[model samples]
Target: MNTAAPALEMTGLTKSFGTMRALDEVDLVVEAGTVHCVLGENGAGKSTLCHVVGGSLVPDEGGLRLYGSPYAPRRPADALAAGIAMVHQHFSLVPTLTVGENLRLLRLKNLPRRVARVRDEYGLDLDLGARVSELPVGVRQRAEIVKALLREPRLLVLDEPTGVLGPAETDALLATCRRIADSGHAVVLVTHKLGEVARAGDAATVLRGGRVSGGGPLAELPPERLVPLMIGRPADSLDAGLAGTIGLAADEGVRETGGEAPEAGASGGRREASGPAPRALRLRDVSVRRPDGTTALDGVCLDVGHGEIVGIAGVEGNGQSELMALLGGSLAPAAGRVELGGRNVTRAAPRERSRAGLGVVPEDRLHEGCVPPLRVADNLFLGRLERFRRYGVLLDRRAMDRAAESVLTEHGIRAGGPGALMSSLSGGNQQKVVLARELALDPLICLAAAQPTRGLDIGAVGAVHSRIRGAAASGTGVLVVSSELSELLVLCDRITVAYRGKLLGPVDPAEPDARERIGALMLGAHAPDSGAESAVRTAAES
Candidate 1:
């Protein structure tokens, strides 16, 4: 048997975009039988490196060795034809089509027909006819995997694979990735989760500022050591609030200069929460039906207290998005009461909701949070533009700049100019703009969806978390729905577990039955029979 070269190899790779030097002379080696992790912060050239490998971009300069031979892919098709499949953070599956149909559209010969029989063979809960849009986030991710595997690639590159997935979903996906590696296909796992490095990775390469910061066996260094190398500095220990915000330490830092000073974690010491609490939000027996007529939320209920943070934790796709929309006032409940700050506003418009002291950080921030073409200051006050208008006459640039500058100072959001287009920012800074706009509303309640900090570095993560906790401490009710358990554990005073559209129960973080019980409830290991609905009722009363 021929002792072949590694499945994929790249040496002295470099690339730049305008003044932004995205990638600098980076090297990588991937063996066929092991999972290789590419680590870095957002804008750290991880994506640039992948684009170079996948033929999405012709490198300004670099060389590639594929399957032991010099190879240069002229285009994405060239890479695909050579058996290199890339799955990005965003799913490529067609939302309007069923999983089965989307798979067929890839034209992998008989792959579509074969999907029906052994769809679960890859370890994801998937249905053949389920449309990608109708399917939950986890299942949609599975469709992406199925699409890539259909081509039977010798090498697979997954960018930010676990960014959308919850803990359970991530663990299951990692196992499937390992199986693929064992089958002699090299897999490149790109992620911000340091835990994933220790758990699923066979080998890891850390990239910082467009350069390889470090590389070794996954077991060689602990998280502390690995973090500094990735960011070119020692990781700072933020207060508890900041840690949870930035998707843990891995994403807590890495903010661009002129960006908002990220919020720090709330003081770890618990405060005695009190009342006569100004009302923030209220929901009663909310039920939502899917387009396929399936029930996503069944007679569910919830409430957010002013100046408080109520965190919702659940497995991925357990009515969390539905809950967020219902609160954001985008989707109406089939039967329920919706109230905003002591006002019954079930039938109110989204604009009305915002007018009534409600602000939201959308799950898909790129689309829902900011307008791509809008200026940074304009985006920051997009929802509250009325603040700039006087007598319904003209646009006020000075007032807008003043508002943006205030948010920048308080929240430390960075941007080149108030007139800089929203799309010009890196992800973390863009998120800061979103937060600045919403928080500046001084709303009674803030409904934050998934709030994608998963791929950010540690300092950024800490800032976001700290802001939420700070809001709560200051008495702005926050309804934070996240698939991240660590976030719930650290930032929330009380956490409620939602599973498959049912509330297991709301438990105090200080209670003896906190972590283990919450985890068990999340997995449906054991859920208390009563009081789940009561949490919602209590919110209404509050």
Candidate 2:
């Protein structure tokens, strides 16, 4: 019997622009029928390397050998022809299209009806007739898989596959990848979350500052070890802010391997003002109905105290987006009163909400958080453009530049300048920009929706957590809505598991039961004997 050569080999790969080197002599080896996880921070040459493999970006130097042959794909189709398929962190599926239609989008010759049968066999549970826009985030991702499988590739590259998935969805997606690997194919997983790399990977490659830092099988290094190797240096400390709030003790279990985890949520800060009032965000029977007569937020009633960080965790469709919109001031509450900072603001415009001491880090930052076309400094100061003004009728560029520089340095943002276009920054940097801008407002109440989603490495995530915790500590009410249970467990003081559309109450997150129970809840299962409802009921009604 003859053994086959490695499925793919890349050596001394390099790419540069002017004085900056995007990829500097990078090397990667992926074996057939095995999973190789590549770990890196944002802008650590992961995307550039993948672009070279996918034939989107040409490498400046070095070579690639696919199956012992020189590999150069001029177009994405060229890579597709060579049996290489890529699933990106962000997918491109028509919201209006169906599963079967999406699968048949690439292959006009293939029968749509025939491919729909294959989708079911995989237990992907995609309703071919259902619209992609109407489906959940997980279902949309599944459609991307079906789109890739239609090409039937020999090698699969998944970039941050679980970035947007919840606990349950992430497990399911990892199972899909393993099944594909079992069928005599190669898998390359790119991610910054060390947990995912440690859990799902068979072999590991660490990339830091645009270079390969280490290599070997997964067993050779634990997630803890692989992290520092990928980051080149130990990430900065957790800043003490998150540790106090998230229950981080001296032991620090699940040690970080890559970037430092952001500080935990604003844990201990100013005490809540005491009075007849509960010092909480009170919404009385808030109802939001769409133009089409579809009710998104039902008569929801809830309160978040002045010095507390309240987190709402749920699957994608479970009114998380709608609730965020209501709180953030993007959509007005159709009925009932909204109160914050001892004032009514339900009928107020978004700008009015911002003026009423309300800060927001929206879910879709690219669309609403920051304008991509604007410069980083301009966007950073967009909220407080007036603050930079020295005169009654002037825009202060110098003051704004100084503030922008301070934010970049304080938050560890890597960018060319405050004048640098926001579009040029990496995803994590963009998120940092958003956080810096919102926190600068110093609002009394903050509503964050998936603030740290795409492009964040584990280290940066820790920093974001610390800041959020700081705000709550400073006596600013905070409400966070996210799909990742692990994130809520780490950053939230009290977690409310939202299923379908109903709001579950604030439950304390602890070990042992959290991972398993949260996973089950995300899948729409009744919580274990010790569940969200029971946990909420037993808590001293504070």
Candidate 3:
């Protein structure tokens, strides 16, 4: 432990947004050449504390010292100048600029060489000439990390860095973190995953209800103790939604598909009942081409039966986004067709698809799900605004407010009220708003949710999963596309793998080797024939 002085220290930090106390009398300490993990559930003041430290938001009260000197950065530039860099959970790159161009904008001397050096050192492979918007979500996330590392800050802060990474990428990034710490840099990792905390951290701090509840060396406070502190409850007390995440047996309410393992690649092996369930959605030979002329989805075919939840598992860039776009009707397929409720919707517009009872919870919630500037009431009634029309023109404000109030309560969203601005809510609450609105529509045929709980806490993840399963129980087919294999196993009736624009296996999660089989499919290790072969392999090892 090279602790001449603490690299960063905060004392009694407090931040308030109107009536909400985001961080209350919080304290944190990070030592040089060590990884300090901040563990917290959503709204536990983790991001707020980070923002105050990074100078993006000024704290209303409290004090901070950098390397034993009084420090208060008036702006992000000041923090940067003080050798502190933060990689936010969200990317902050210009969509129009290329990766290299974005790096050069930092005005760091010898930009190309610095980026090249950092990329090579950290095992980051990015196309410098590719525009930010042209890259897949995963690659863009990598670009963000590379951009931050280019600063070579003494104190590095990363918020949920592995949330979007695949297994290999996550392992590589963790290894890089170790190297960064060994080289005398202090790393502050803000995450909700306990596994990461156990594996990567030297010291850990647990936050609950905007206060520091417990913290100590990783060895002194293992995950078994840390989880309860973060959640403010015993791990065993957790419901079905979160228990399975940490390898604990799920609670009784959590549905588990049971039977002898389904035959791999066999549609017959789906955990759903064997009788002919009506098809809710279908895609036939769907192909998509990116604007940069790459084949994003190559002749993909899929289907989801009513009363079923189909999980799509793959590395982030493997046609998931393209598939989502096709389902949402945001992008037209270059070939093939899409059908919803047996109606050809291949050429339907987004609004038309929604009209046909196709609900979508897009991955990029900040931009696609709801308008942040709008009031909660307006956002809740966004797409269905027509229903509040009294005379086909005059709006019914009172009706909308009442409806919004009902949704807020029914969805269990913790916010001021319907009058509150959507931007004022935390990330998890924002997702609840999206889910409430989408599910309230009673989507008859299909619900396409991509990374529905990307940045939510365990409680929020549980809520989202329960709601999705409830919808399936009501006979609505759901397509859950996520990078988390564990999540797929928890929620889907039949888990499938997508690889390099191709669809493979409808593996039953009941299979003993489901996780390993999914991992193999994601890495393209198994080559079940594209069409019929994918349809009939037994879930058991063949």
Candidate 4:
């Protein structure tokens, strides 16, 4: 045994914001040439720990060491100079620059050769000339990873790196992580997904409520042990068969992996298709053209019935963005029609759409859903402020605050009252705020939610699912657009898969092969290959 100090180590690290503590006496150690997985639910101090190590935030207590020496970094530059590189879950690329230009900013000589080597080694196919703004979300995420790897740091930290990747991309990235670790570099992966941990981790550290619940060799602690550590309860307690499946154990008594999808619906189980329900939302031959003159969505036709939940599932950037924009009324269709509750709303403005009982939770919550600079109270009543007018001219501030307070409480939002800034809330809490506002509208027709639970923890995700289901139960049609297959499998009565600007299948949820069928459709397997496989792979790796 080497018996040397760890590549990196933290002892008694504690951090706080206001009265709440984000981290408390947290400790972690990473060995060289090893992949260490940090497991935790949201707000469990996982990101905070990464931020401290990456020099984005300073801890109020405790200390850190690198290679047996005290290490304290004041900023990202300091950490980078100390041979540490971190790829955040949210991309940090300059939107205006090309991929080639972004790599050049790292100030490394032989950049092209390095990039080419990484692409070959990591199974990535990125277009250097593509503008960051022009690329899809998955492509931009790949660019971020490439940028970080260009540094060739001794210590690499990836915060939820696979969140944006498809299954193939995720496997490739995990293989790349192993290769990096084999070369004697330390790797720290912060993630909530148990499958990834089981597949790639050499060591594991589980965090719950800002403290370490368990830490040991990955093989020693299976998902059964890790799940209880993460949520303070057994996996079966949370959901049926979650523990065994998560652990990849031999005994999967409840559901088969890659087997038939369950034959059930939301909370109340499967509902018989009552013939010919009223259409809550309808799109006929809808098409969207991007500024670059590319057809984002082409001749797409879909509809949702009143009192039903329909899920849209596909790999990221498979016309999902275009579909969302069209549904939200932010983009006018180039051809065909959009109808909300049997009325033609093809050219209706966003405000008009909202007024006609359309509620939307956009994919990008930070930029589109809520204003960071505004207080929670103001943001809650953002688009529908006219209702608060008292004398037809004067605004009623008190009424707004009162309404905000009630919604906040009803949504179980934990904040510094309604006066708290939207920027100050955590990602999960920010999502709750968005949900509170949109759902409170009590829309008559349909509620379209795009990536509603993208970055939430298990607990927060459960809450969001319940609210969406509640809307459907209340006779409001619900359309959920998500990249998380598990979420779609659980939440939707029917699932639709999109590929290459084409929509397929309101596949019956009761069908045993629902997931398999949808996955095939998502990859455009039913029709003769339109080269979408190659394009989607390129999108995944870019």
Q: What ranking emerges by lDDT with the best candidate at the front?
A: 3, 4, 1, 2
lDDT against true structure, model 1: 0.71
Instruction: Give candidate 1's TM-score.
Output: 0.86
Q: Residue 112 deviation, candidate 2, in Å?
A: 4.1
Alpha-carbon lDDT, every model: 0.71, 0.68, 0.79, 0.77
Q: Considering TM-score, which of the candidate structures 1 and 2 is the better prediction for this target?
A: 1
Best by lDDT: 3
- CA shift of 135, model 1, Å: 3.2
Evaluation by lDDT, superior candidate among 3 and 4:
3
TM-score of each: 0.86, 0.84, 0.91, 0.89
lDDT score, candidate 2, position 496? 71
RMSD of each: 5.0, 4.9, 4.0, 5.2
**Lowest-scoring 10 consecutive residues by lDDT in candidate 1?**
256-265
lDDT of 1 at 124: 62
Compared with the true structure, what per-residue lDDT tens digits does model 3 show for residues 107-212? 9888878887877898888889999887777788899889889898888898878877877888778887888889888899987777677678899988888999
Q: How do the candidates rank by TM-score, highest first?
A: 3, 4, 1, 2
Give candidate 4 misplaced runs (Cα > 4 Å).
Answer: 1-3, 241-263, 267-278, 386-406, 528-542
